[model samples]
Target: MHRWMDGVIGALLVLLVLVGALRWVDTTWRPVVVLQSVGPFVVIGLGLLFVGTLLLHRWWMLLPVGVCAAVAWAMALPTFFAHTVPGPANFTVMSANLYYGRANADQVMAAVRAHEVDVLVLTEVTPDVVDRLDTAGLTRLLGHRAGEAHADTFTGTMIYSRLPMTVVSGTANPAIEQTPSLQPEVVLTVDGQQVRLKAAHPMAPIPDQTAQWRAGLTALQRWKGDVPAGDRLVLAGDFNASFGHPGFRQLADGLVDAQRTAGQGWVRTWPVVGRRMPPFVALDHLLSRGLGVVKAGDVAFHGSDHMLVWASYTLR
Candidate 1:
């Protein structure tokens, strides 16, 4: 009976190792995307396997255990190292999804004022919240802005900046029906530098919205702004997808995630379920191509489901 039980444990360990191997090469299979969210959990399972093998005095079993542990670490390696950020930042930026107007206006504005955020990106905007934002006098700090108040749905996206921003002609992508995912291009002249900014919130990656979600990320990946080659480009918002997702990996391959650059990728900013409970995922982000992140992190604000994601960058 003891021999049988040992055989069962060995088989289970081999199965877990195979599952970890599949995650790296199974990108094309859509259903396998669900396993992407559990990459970190695979590491936990590998640790258990290592401990179990030692307890059974099967030293030879360590070979498979080591191989599986190495695979899991490689899958999660990007989260472990910090990308170098050089020089002093000229300005700071922040992004947040306000839970469809449920976030506290006072607290939101307070964070803006306290952080002195130069650029603010908001997702899931509503007419009521827009009015409250205007009333809170954030315009006193952020003078140039663009956002159409949509009363029908939580599809609104807005960007407010301290630098003068002008709408870039013919910059909107009309194929995207989801307003939050629509990339609104604006050129801000900062210290005589032309900085192009775009805010995007892709469709959520739930089972039913996979097509729409992929489309949203694809649109952003294919988007080409009218900015000059020398000008800076900034992409910031709640992408609804993380680095683990294939779509974000494609889009982010061309840009640098500020949190990842600053070694703060583990600081999650969504589903503000509780102060003590760690967030299940990090959904909000700030990305850029021509900027270097000087500092980056997130904070929980009152009433919103998402914590505010903030980053400071220097021209690169």
Candidate 2:
């Protein structure tokens, strides 16, 4: 019976290694993408399993488990170290999902005011929610705005800025077709510099929506690649994809993840309010280029399942 249990444990460990491997491959399959979202946790589990193999005297399983754990750790280690470029943090940005317009407007405004946020990216915004936000003094604070609110569905994305901004149509990427949610891009004039910003909320990779999710991220990658190397760009929102997803990694290639740059290790930003379980994966992100990250972190609000992700940056 002990031998059989050891065999079962070894098999589970092997399966986990396969799941961890998904971080390097692109796939639109629902299960694989879902598992990949928790890549950091998979590395942790792999480490624990490697220890278990030794503690249980499963010598035959030691080599495989140890090697896989080492590989996973090697890949994940860099994300924990600060890569901040030296500069004064003159700009602050925040992204939040409104839980289909259910998130408390007062709480959201309070966060904006507290952070002295220069720009705000919002997802799942509805017409009524926009009114509530204005009522809560959002317009008085930020003033400039772009993107339209959806009256019938949670398809709206908007960028609000204290600096002057105008909505710009994204370069049409054929790779993105029929995506379920709206991703709005705008150009903000900051200190005589033009900074392009996108409020991005790609479709979630649930069972039937996996293909659209993949396309949405692919579109983002193409959009990022098309930007001139010298241009400043920022993409912020509930991406619905993590670093584990190869598509996300591709999109993030030339950009910096604010949280990673600040070395906020394994920060999770979803399911903070309505779920039975604690937040396990980070679906929200702030990715940028031509900006020096000074600090970054997440904030809990009253009603949204997603925590607000904010980052401070300087011109690079």
Runs of candidate 1 exceeding 4 Å displacement: 1-31, 75-78, 169-181, 224-230, 274-277
The digit string of per-residue lDDT tens for model 2 on 124-235 reads 8899889999999999999988777776556777788998887785322334633556777888887888889987877888888888888888888888888899999999
Q: Write down the lDDT that model 1 would get.
A: 0.73
Best-performing candidate as measured by TM-score: 2
Backbone clash pairs for candidate 2 read none
Number of clashes in every candidate structure? 0, 0
lDDT scores of the candidates, listed in order: 0.73, 0.85
Q: Write the per-residue lDDT of candidate 1 for residues 187-222, one digit (tens) a residue.
A: 777667777888877777677677777778777776
Question: What is the alpha-carbon lDDT of model 2 when measured against the actual structure?
Answer: 0.85
User: What range of 10 consecutive residues in model 1 has the weakest lDDT sum?
Assistant: 170-179
The true-versus-predicted C-alpha distance at residue 20 of model 1, in Å, is 4.4
